[model samples]
Target: MKPTFIILSFFFFGMVLHLHAQSKVDSLTYYYGVVNQPKSNIQLAKAYNFFTKQKEQSIKRKDIEKAVFHLRLLASIEKKMGLLSDSEISSVEALRLLDGMTNPEMIKENRIGIYNHLGIVYRSLDNFSKALEFYSKSLELVEDEASKATLLNNIGNLYLDKNEYSRALVYFEEAYEKSPRLDLKMKARVLDNLGLAQAKLTLPGALSNLLEALSLRKTIDYIPGVITSYGHLSDYYLDKGDRETAQDYAQKALEQAKQLNNPQYLESTLATLVLLNGTPEVVQYKKLRDSLEKASVRAKDNFEYYRYQFSEQQRLFEESEFKRQKLFLTLILVILVFVAIYVVGRVKHNKEKLLKVYETETRISKKVHDEVANDMYQIMAKLQANNETEEVLDHLEAVYRKTRDISKEHSEIDVEGNFSETLMELLKGFNNDEVRVIVQSISKVDWRHFSNLQKTTIYRVLQELMVNMRKHSRASYVVLKFEQKGKSMAIQYTDNGVGTAIYKKGGLQNTENRMKSIKGSITFESNNDAGFKASIRI
Candidate 1:
């Protein structure tokens, strides 16, 4: 064979591979965007197929990021479909791929996403501790208020499932406060959860929150949320000694559950109605609930079996990929040993220069957009005045100085050793003349047990929480307590401030993300009446 013909064949092979990979990625990205929408299972199934193909292509191309992305998507779909075991396997596989990559940022969002999804799966499987573990892991990685709010709510729900009503109530309140006003569905769910938790505790606002949640759900046409709300309302009214109202709401919930054909809600509503109305209908509802519960158990068993089979198939595919990668690596190593041994040496230098250029460009763009451009625009408005030219010049100078200060702040982070000491110092800084800051058991934690990275995460998390308290809580007293629990350390923070609604913000999100990166967990507790309390575990 001629050398030129051989080169042409290689080029064709490369082009074909590139096109195929691109196609798979495009398909996966498209499906990912719509996976959560109503009636999207069909599209998700198509996306799943593409994800499998992408995995194969990624393995062939030795692209760890792409492979992780594919596995993450697969896990998400599996979780959505109630295939908990399969979802867990896919998520673990994706996390494993991170070990081979230099930068995990490409799939950072997905990594935390899978953790939260796995938590949901575990929660569904009735593994409360495992669910909390995964949720905590996700909380550490959550960077946005919305995601944090969702995770907090999920954790609260897990506590609800565990029958820890007080713990659940804390998270529910935080989630309700932090969630955006625009997210009616989420807010309704939170309200419903709060109502349930409150009702369990026989709290004063249980009926109001539940009724409001039901109204909101009905307004938004969220049938599922409304159904759950009905059940909660029935429970609340029943507990309030109003059997008539309870029976009415229970019947309404049963009707909706029947319309939706949801066995879980059907069983719940039927059981509630059986207690409320002790007629001959009680016997029929009990029988129906028992039968449906049995069927639901069987269905779950079958789903698990199918998930097992799917996992076996995935295992086989991975085996094949491992073999293919081994052979591919051998071939590449042989070729590179001779032709590209020296070529690889300059790659790092070029990459570093490119990265520096990118960083500088990003900083300049952000400063211009966030500060310089807005300042200039204000200056332009002021320049419309006949005698405002000098004022405009002064404003421009101020903008420049502000921009320079911001740039410096952005570039430099106050990183210190001695995690406990640093944390104490930071907390002291927040302890103003009005705010009486109390530190408890700070010396009890064996900070030596944690690595610098873990310590740094702990410091930063406490700092963010305190900043939030100072900025929003307006509390006069703050308590910081540290406790060592077996191998892990826990920090409990409480504040007596005017606790307001918590929302997703960059600082809180970053704190969560930092904790997530270090596999630590943080929980926020607050209410309109009670002051704010936060618990951090590492």
Candidate 2:
């Protein structure tokens, strides 16, 4: 062949390979997004099929870069879907592909992504040491702070779980400070880890860190972290025999668990609730555990769903999640905005009714005190001057009867509206153009079920939450949900917001009181990069 023809041929081949690589990335992302939405196993099955073919074809083409990328994804997805050693084989294949790459920079980038994933797989397998080793390698080749910070955070968590508090803090703080960008989950994890470390140090920072992390989780809707943080706090208080504080935190954690639909968390929260001073915590624990066993079976029945739908289903799932999120927000706006208006109307109506009662009672009281009393006085004067004692006594009796009726009218209390309406309003307030919001609301109930005092208290709790989210959380997305199960209603809110840098607990006290007043409950979570989550159960 002529030299010119050879050069052009090579150029064309390289271009094809590059395009193919890009295509593979697009597919991975597309499929990954689909898995994020609500879907059936048919989807995952399709994704697994498509990607599997892509991986095989890439290997056959000797396109190592593309091959490894697909393999990494296949591994990760397999692990998450509960497929065992097959995922590990994919990771090994990814590393094998790397051996063929010659360019140093390209190799570094690929290796970083590969090793991070290796760490994920190993961590899932409980091979923490190997996970740590690969994560460290990924860190060494890192060009971006975000990548390094995430690795550091992961490493620190591994150490924390191993009970090496001091070592954990070193990496945790390093990641926290050096990380230019943070995620909600990462930040919450760091804060919670920091709290654990600080507690060991006996620093005032411990409580503050715990509280800050707890609060941030609430703002950003980091439900799991919120629940964990509360449990930690409850444990801290429990050890100290601060029954009141322990009970408060325990209750908060339980509320969050219910909101998240996490049976495992609820089980723990129920156990803690049993320990609270007033309730029969043991009874609640038994009941909760029995319920959890049943739910686990249900979850398991749906477990293989993701595996079977692995391909096209995954794509659809993500699209559905996006659409569902938008629809959720729209529904929230319609329901909560209307409910808020309803609450406001109810509040006004009650005030009006109360005022009418006050006015009528006042008018009657005044009539007895002023007009009827004067008549009695005149009768008494007549009795004294003209000897009419019997008439004076009769007038006094009539005046007393009128005064008693006035007292009865004024003593009655009527507060009849739906607390759900008020909660809906509070959630609706969190929705703004700066962020997207998804709401899943339970049925609205009659506020009349609650006392006047309870109504005011719960409203204030939700208000405190909205205020923190709007003011402190720079969240672009929020998820508000309400669900009713059996006798209880869970009002849950979550957001993806970078919230409080440290502990913020002043608002939580009010939140707790509001739930407690209505015999309801709350649980929440928050963090630096992710956002916050809180559940109010009534």
Please list the C-alpha lDDT of all candidates, in the order they appear.
0.75, 0.70
Over 4 Å off in model 1, which ranges?
1-34, 40-70, 180-182, 254-538
The best candidate by TM-score is 1
Total clashing pairs for each candidate: 6, 50
* Per-residue lDDT over 1-538 for candidate 2, one digit per residue giving the tens place of the 0 to 100 score: 6999999999999999999999978977878754442133456666777778988998899988778777876776676565545666676667656769888887788778877876776665555787798899899889787787888878987786677878888988888786347666667667777777777656567888788778878887767678889998997787667989999989989987787654557778987787575457666777687678646533443322124337446768989999999999999999999999998887777566645644665677666666665676676566677766676667777776655544433332333555565456556655778867676644544444445655555555655776677678878887767565655556677777885444536777657744654457777777678678887777
List all candidate RMSDs to the true structure.
38.2, 39.5
Alpha-carbon lDDT of model 1: 0.75
User: How far does residue 193 in candidate 2 sit from its true spot (Å)?
Assistant: 1.9
Candidate 1, residue 462: CA error in Å?
Answer: 90
Candidate 1 weakest ten by summed lDDT: 406-415
lDDT of 1 by residue, 1-538 (tens): 6999999999999999999999856865687764543234566677677678878899899998888877877887776665666777787777667767887565577768877887887777766777888899889987888788889899999988779999999999998888674288888888889989999998888888888999999998876687888888887887789889888998999988787664556767877776676777777877787668556744553344235547778989999999999999999999988566565545445445534543664577577667776776566566666466676677776776666544532332234555567667767877778798999998777766776556655665676777677667888899888889777988888898876565546777776665655567777777785898778888
